[model samples]
Target: MPKFFNTAGPCQSDIHYTLPTGDRLPQLEKLIAQRNYFVIHAPRQTGKTTAMLTLAQELTASGAYTAVLLSLEVGAVFPHDPGAAERAILDEWKQSIKFRLPENLYPPEWPDTNAGSMIGTLLSNWAKKASRPLVVFLDEIEALSDETLISVLRQLRSGYPNRPQGFPHSLALIGMRDVRDYKIAGGGSQRLNSSSPFNIKVESLTLQNFSLADVKNLYKQHTEATGQIFTPEAIERAFYLTDGQPWLVNAIARQATEVLAPDVATPITVDLINQAKEILIQRQDTHLDSLAERLREDRVKAVMQPILAGQDLPNVPNDDIQYLVDLGLCKIDNGQGLEIANPIYQEVLPRVLSYTTNASMGRIESRWLSDKGELMPMELLEAFLGFWKQHGEPLFKSTPYPEIAPHIVLMAFLHRVVNGGGTIEREYAIGSGRMDICLHYGKVILAMELKVWREGKRDPLDEGLQQLDKYLSGLNLDTGWLVIFDRRPDLLPLSDRTTTEIATSPAGRSIIVIRG
Candidate 1:
C-alpha cells in the first residue's frame, strides 16, 4: 500500500510518512545508557508515542539491551484501585512486549505479586530473566491517577536500587505533563509528596515539535513519493501557522492532499494550506477538541481569561501558567512575554471562547450584503450597531469572561460575517486592554479596534485613534473603525448609550468611531 500521513495513531515507518524520530531527541540513548530514570512529556499528539516506540525498537535492535514500550492508559479506568490498575497495565504490557520484542528477548512469565508491589515486582523478575539489561518506556504515566499514579511512582522509585538485576536498568515515565504536574483523581496535586514519588536522579525532557528543517524534510518525502510538490511558500506558511506542531503539520498536508486538492499532479500551494486550516478548525478534530475541552478548566482559565481580554494576567500560580505552556496552548517569548502558542491556536482560542454566544445569536439576514454578494462594509457596521442595541447587553451577561465580554460579543457578531463567506483575523494587544480585528471579504478589508472604558480610566479615544492609525497603516488602508465600549459600573443601558460617528485618525485617515 502507498504510504500516507498518519494522524490517528503513532506513526509506523513502513506505512506512514515519518521523520527520524530519534533526531528530535538525541539524548535518549545516552540517558538510557546511563541507567537513569527520566520523564518524557509534551502536549498530546506531539509524537511522544511514536518517538518512544521507535527508540524502543532501535535499542532492542542494538542487542545491548532489551527495550519495550508499554502504556498505562488502560489503568486510568481504575483510578482509585491501584491493584486493578497495575494488573491492567501489566496485562497491556504483555501484549506490548509480544509486539515490540523478539520472542527470545521476551522475559520469563510475570512475577505474581500482591496489589501494592505488582509493577515493581514484575519489572524486577522480568529484568532478572532478560539476557540483557532491561530498558522500559512507560507511556501515559499520567493516566494512572490518584492512588494508582502515586502508587506506581513510589513503586518505581523504591525499585531504583535494584537496577540491572532486580529491576529494569533504565525506565522512563512518559506523558503529557512533567512529573510534578501529574493529576490526582478528584482534585489537585496535594495528594502527592513533594519528593517521595518520582524524585529519581535524572532529567525531565520534552519532545519538541518539528523544526523548519524537519518540516521541509517531511514534506519533501511526500513530494518524492507522489511526484507532487509543496511550494516553498506553502512550507513556510505551514511552519508559521503550526509552529511545527507535529499533528498540525501532518493534518494540514493530509487535508490538502487527501481532501482539498487530492490530485498528485497538482502542487500543494499556500492557498491550499490556508484552506486546510479552515477545514480543520471547522472539523474540530479530536486533537483540537481535546484542547478546547481544557479551556473549561479553572486552572486553564486563571491565565487564559486575562490573556484573551488583553489585560495583564492576574496573580496566578507559576505552575498554572506552566500548565498552559505544557499543554501547548501558550508559550513565553523572551521579549513578547506570554502569548498563544501559534497562529492557528491564536485563531482558535477566541472562537472557542465565544462559541456559546455565537450559537445563541438569533437569525441573521442578508441585509448587509450587496446584490453581488459582496459584504458592504457600511451595511455590516450598521448591522452590528443594530445587533448591539438588541443583543449586546444580553451577550455581556452571557459572556464567560467579564473582562472580555465586549470583545466576545463583537466577535460573535462578526462570526455572522464569516458565515457569509468572509474571514476575520484578530490580534490582542496584551495589557493594553485592546483587540484588533481585520475583516477580509471579496475586495473589502475592514479594520476595527475594540477598547473598553473602565472605571477610573479616561475615555480611550485618543489612544485608540493612535493605535488604529498604526493598524490601518499595516493593512495599507486609508480608513478603519475604532470602537470604545463603556464598561463602567454606572454605564447607561446599551440601546440608549450606543452611538457612532465619523472622525479622522492621528494619521489623517478617515476613521469611524463608535462609542457605546
Candidate 2:
C-alpha cells in the first residue's frame, strides 16, 4: 500500500511519510547513559510521541536498556484523587510493558498501594526485577495535575537517587509544556517551581517543528514512493504557511495529494498548496480548532490581544510568554519582540475572532463588488461608513477582547466584501500601533491601514499616512486608505464622527484618510 501523510498519533513507517525520529533527538542515548531524569516538551502533534516510542524500541532492541514509553493521560481523570490516578497509571504501565517487552523483561507485579506512593513503589519493584537497567518515558505528564501531579512528581523525586537497582536508571516526563510553568490547579494552586519535587531533571528539552530541509525531505519521500512530484515552490509554500508545524505540513500535502490532485502524475504546485491551506483553515480541523480554542485562555489573550490590535506590549509575565511559546501560538522574533508563530497563524487569529461577526454581517449589502466582480475601494468605504453609523457600536460591544474590538469589527465588515471572490491579507504586531490590510479582488488591489485615537494620544493621521506610504510601496500600489478610529470617551456619536478625506503620503502616494 502507498504511504500517506499522517496527522493523528504516531507516524508508522509502513503507512506514513516520516522524517527520521532518532535524528531529531540525538541526545537521548547520552542522557540514558548518564542516568538523567529530564523533561521533553513541545506543542501538540510535533512528533514527540513518535520520537520517544521509536527511541524506546531502538533501546530495547539494542540489548543495553529495557526502555518503555507509557502515558499518564488516564490519571488526569482522577485529578483530585492521587491514589486513584496512581492506580490507573500503574495499570496502564503494566499493560504497556506486557505488550511491548519480551516475557523475560516484563515488570514484577506492582504492590497494592495507596495513591500517593503508588508510582514510586511500582518503579522500585520493576527496577529491582529487571534483567537490565530500566529507562522509562512518561508521556502526557501535563495531563496529571493538582494532587495527582504533585504526588507523581514527588514519588519520582523520591526515587531519583536509587537508580539501576531501586529505581529506573533514567526517566523522562513528556508533555505539551516544560516543567517550569506547571501550576497544580484545584486545591493545590501553587506554581511547581523547578527548585523542588522533580528537580532531579537535568534538562527540559523541546522538539522543534520540521525545518525547511526536513519538510523537503518529508515530501521527497512521497515523490519516491509514488512518483507524485511536489514542486519546489509547493514545498517552500508549505513551509512558509505552516512554519514546519508537523500536523499542518502533513495535512497540506495530504489534502493536495488525496483531494486536490489525486492524479499522481500531475506535479503539485504552490496554487494547489494554497487551496489546501484555505480548506484546512475553513474546515477548522481538530488541530487548528484546538489551537483556536486556546485563544480564549487568559494567558493566550494577554499576548495575542495586543498583537491583534497592533498596540504596545502589555505587562505580561515571562512565564505567560513561555507558556504560549510552548503551545506554539507565538514566538519571540529575534530581538524585535513577540509575534504570532507564523504567517498562517497571523491570518487565522483575526478570522477566528471575527467569525461570528462575519456570519452576522449578512444584512449589509455587498455594494463594493462591481457587476463584473471587481472590488471598488471607495464603494467598500461608503458601505463601511453606512454600516458604522448604524451597527458599529453594537458589534464593537459584542467583541470578545476590548483591545482589538475596532480591528475585529472592521475585519468582520471586510470579510463580507471579500467573502466570495476577494482575499484580505493582514499584518499586525505588537509595537506597530497599526493594523495593515491588503484587499485583493481580480486585478484591483486595495491597501488599508487601521489605527486608533485614544484619549491622550495625538490624532494618528500623520503617522498613519507615512506608514501607509511604506506599505503601499511594498505592495507596489500607488493608492491606499488610512483609517483612524476615534476611541476617546469625549468623542461624538459614530454618525457624526465617521468621515473620509484625501491625503498624500511621504512617498507622494495618494491615500484616503478616514476618521471614525
**Full-model lDDT for every candidate:** 0.87, 0.87
In model 2, the runs with Cα more than 4 Å from the true position are 187-190
- Clash list (residue pairs), candidate 1: none
> What overall lDDT, based on C-alpha atoms, would model 1 receive against the true structure?
0.87
Give the per-residue Cα lDDT of candidate 2 at 452: 90
Q: How many backbone clashes are present in model 1?
A: 0
Task: Give TM-scores for every candidate, taking all chains together and pairing residue i with residue i.
Answer: 0.97, 0.96
Give the Cα-based TM-score of candidate 1 against the true structure: 0.97
Per-residue alpha-carbon lDDT of candidate 1 for residues 232-317, written as tens digits (9 for 90 to 100) = 99999999999999999999999999998789999999999999988877678999888988987888888888787678988898
**Backbone clash numbers for all candidates listed:** 0, 1
